[model samples]
Target: MALKGSFERYGAVAVASHWLSAALILALIPLGFLMQDATGETRLIFYRIHVLVGVVAGMLTLFRLLWWAAFDHRPAPLAASRAQHMIARITHVGLYAVLIALVVSGVAMTAKSNLGAGLVSGDVALISPSPIRVPPRLAHGVAARLLLALLVLHLAGALYHHWMKRDETLSRMLPRTR
Candidate 1:
């Protein structure tokens, strides 16, 4: 497999970043729900894990953007019209925008709540089931829901291309031997 993308396939880096980000997002969603509902040390532990994973995922996102800016050379839309191509591009941009918003809001919420420093220094116990609602925290929740919707749309589009349109659109992103 090539480390750089070609007209027919994604690079190894792109494929790895895509899968890792997806996995992290999938894990983080459940963790977010659990942490929000939890209390005491349980919530604290979950929050720490969530924040750490989110940071890692955010770093991966940064690298993915850099990869696109510096090295991306993937194939064009195989048989799609100009309108379809535009829509695809919009969706991709929206996904990245939503992801960045989610991470930023989450980090801001953590800082505003003092969860990170408190967790480290034992300054305050993260035991509040009904924690204070700040703007960033609220935005984080909203972004989570929006991200879910975007992910569903992305999956639907890929499935449509693979099952109905009989295209390699999905396979091109899939991590498989060529």
Candidate 2:
């Protein structure tokens, strides 16, 4: 498969990056919730995994945005009207923005907790002195919930295009031959 996208469909790089980021975000959300009610060693483990995945997703998202800007060609609008096109663009942009916010807030939360060094040093003892609430941490939680809602909308839109409208919209992002 081609590594770069064409006007008609996403290429291999785009598809792989998209799915990777999506999977990481999906995993991180559940981890976040689980960590909240967790304690001791389990909580420490969850915290480490959450931050590590967040960092990976952050880097991947930055690369995806840069790659898309440089290599992706816009396909013809599948929307029937300018309004629909605008809506589609806005939703996509919103999703990207939320994801970036989530990453930033997560890092800020980590910094506020002073866990970076301990997390790296393999000292679960230093994982937390206590759970203190930080503004960025609160924002991160809010962003996570918001991402879930947006993801549902995204999936629904794709399903609408495929099952309801019966167009190439869904396939455009799929791995397929030209």
Candidate 3:
């Protein structure tokens, strides 16, 4: 597959970034939930790993955005009603915005609390008695829910295009095998 997107479909870079971001988001959702209830050593370990993965995901997301802005062009939209096209555009933008918000809020929460220092020094005491009612923490939770909703909408749109409209909407993002 070409490294740069063509007029018809996404190239290898876009395809890879999309899937990688999806995987990271999937991992993060579960990890975020798991770490919340965990305790003792397990909690510490989960927090460390979650932060590490979140950072990677954030960097990858930024890279993807920059790549698209500076080097890649998206394929032309498939034929669809104005409403469908508008919804698709809105969902796409929402996904990017939510992902960015999640990353920023998460980082802010960590930095503003003991989480960041705990991760650095492996000092359990530093992490105990977590901060309460912080703005960033609240924003992070809200962003997570928004991300989930957007993801479901995005998936539904892809399925609708592939199954009902029978267009290249889904396949355009898939990596070519030959």
Candidate 4:
């Protein structure tokens, strides 16, 4: 199969990226909630894992975007209605936008961290050590929350396509049946 997409099914790259990202996000959401209560070394460990997953997702997001731009794929349209087309483009764009925002905000929030939260381990720091910069943290949190909302809508839309429209929305990403 082509890397971008085939006539009906998703390419290996898109399917791989989608499934990988789904798993990462699943882990991240829980870690995010758990980190609030965790303390000391345990929190740091969770932070490390969360950031690792975030970094991986961020990189994959970027690569997938570039791949789409360079080699766009039209994963077998569902209904081809004007609404569907608009949603496809809008939601897809929103997905990319939110992913980018989440990564940036995560990094920003990390920087404003007051405690010894060292998720990023490099000689050079992205935000550097400082007081708990409330503004960046708040901004990051807000953006992340917005991303979650968008994600829900996206999921609902996908379901609508599969159940109501009986389209290839999910199947496009799944391994080919025939």
Candidate 5:
């Protein structure tokens, strides 16, 4: 069955980017939180991995956003009422916002926070291969918090759609496409 509104199966590029991003975020979030609780070498190791993934995610976000604008390729809207449509659109956009926010926040936190000293790669020079002495204001007090809040909202919306609404909010992203 087809989705509602103009929502259609994402194109090849969109689908590929979507899945790659999903896998990365899914892996990164827990790893990041876990690293926060670690220290010394282990913390350093996770920090490096986190930065490595963040840089890649940042690149992917740019490409995906560009693809969305240039290719005009996106998923079809869900087959729901106007209210549902609005909620779906808001949620989807929020997802993008959160992902970008998280990526940018982490990058800023490292660069401006100068926390990069902790993110060593044994000798890898992915991004200057050094620690940031002071992460920016945007990355610290406000932006990072905003990212975390948006992430919670995004997850809540997903849960709402999945359990409360019993819709295909998450499922549609699957390859099967209903």
Candidate 6:
């Protein structure tokens, strides 16, 4: 496992970042929903956990984007029709954009609503209700939905490449085995 990507496949760092981000985001989607219906001490606990995990995921995602830009290059696109290639590119860009949007909106909502302070003081009253329709909260919700849709498109593309095209597109991101 090289640190940087090769022409054929992603490097170890990229693979690790991809899987870790995927796991975190998957956890977050469910956690976010659960946090909505929670109350009392359970709500506070969920809020605390959600903030902690969300911060980690946001930072990791930011680092991954920086790494891709500054330190790495992805493998060349596997042979495909122009439309397929275009769709893949769009999906990739959308994924990155939506991830960034989610992070930004989450942070903004936290700061604007004093969520961190509320969580720290164990004052659930300080936390804004999810139904308030604030800009950042609204943006966060929209971004989450967009991320889900983009992920579905991404998985569809990967599965198409792996099963239909019988190509290395999916394998390129897979962990290398001995």
Best by lDDT: 3
Residues 1-49, model 1: lDDT tens digits:
7788888988888999999999999999999888877877777788778
lDDT of 4 by residue, 54-150 (tens): 8898998998888777876756665568987897788778878878887887777666664323444422232233323666667656766776777
Model 5 poorest 10 in a row by lDDT: 123-132
Task: Give per-residue CA lDDT, model 3, range 61-96, as digits (tens).
Answer: 899999999999999888999999899989998988
Give the poorly placed runs of model 2, Cα more than 4 Å off. 121-130
lDDT of 5 by residue, 1-178 (tens): 3222135554556657778987887777778667757656666677778878877987898888887787655555555689867765776677677667767667666666436644443432333333443544344335445555666766787688789889777675555633
Clash count of each predicted structure:
0, 0, 0, 0, 17, 0
In candidate 3, residue 115 scores what lDDT? 84
Alpha-carbon deviation at 72 in model 5, angstroms? 3.3
Cα lDDT tens digits for candidate 2, 1-178: 7887777777888889888988998999899898878776787888889988988998999998898788675566675667767767778888899989998988887788656766677676666554537788778878888888889888888888899999999998887865
Q: What is the Å distance of residue 54 in model 4 from its true position?
A: 0.8
Better model by lDDT, 2 or 3?
A: 3
The local distance difference test score of each candidate is 0.83, 0.81, 0.88, 0.72, 0.64, 0.85
The model with the greater TM-score, 1 or 2, is 1
Query: Against the true structure, whose TM-score is highest?
Result: 3
Give TM-scores for every candidate, taking all chains together and pairing residue i with residue i: 0.92, 0.90, 0.95, 0.82, 0.68, 0.93
In candidate 6, how many clashes are counted?
0
lDDT of 2 at 78: 70
- The RMSD of every model to the true structure, in order and in angstroms, is 1.6, 2.0, 1.2, 4.1, 5.2, 1.6
Q: For candidate 4, what is the lDDT?
A: 0.72
lDDT of 1: 0.83
Error of 6 at 107 (Å): 1.3
For model 2, name the residue pairs that clash.
Answer: none
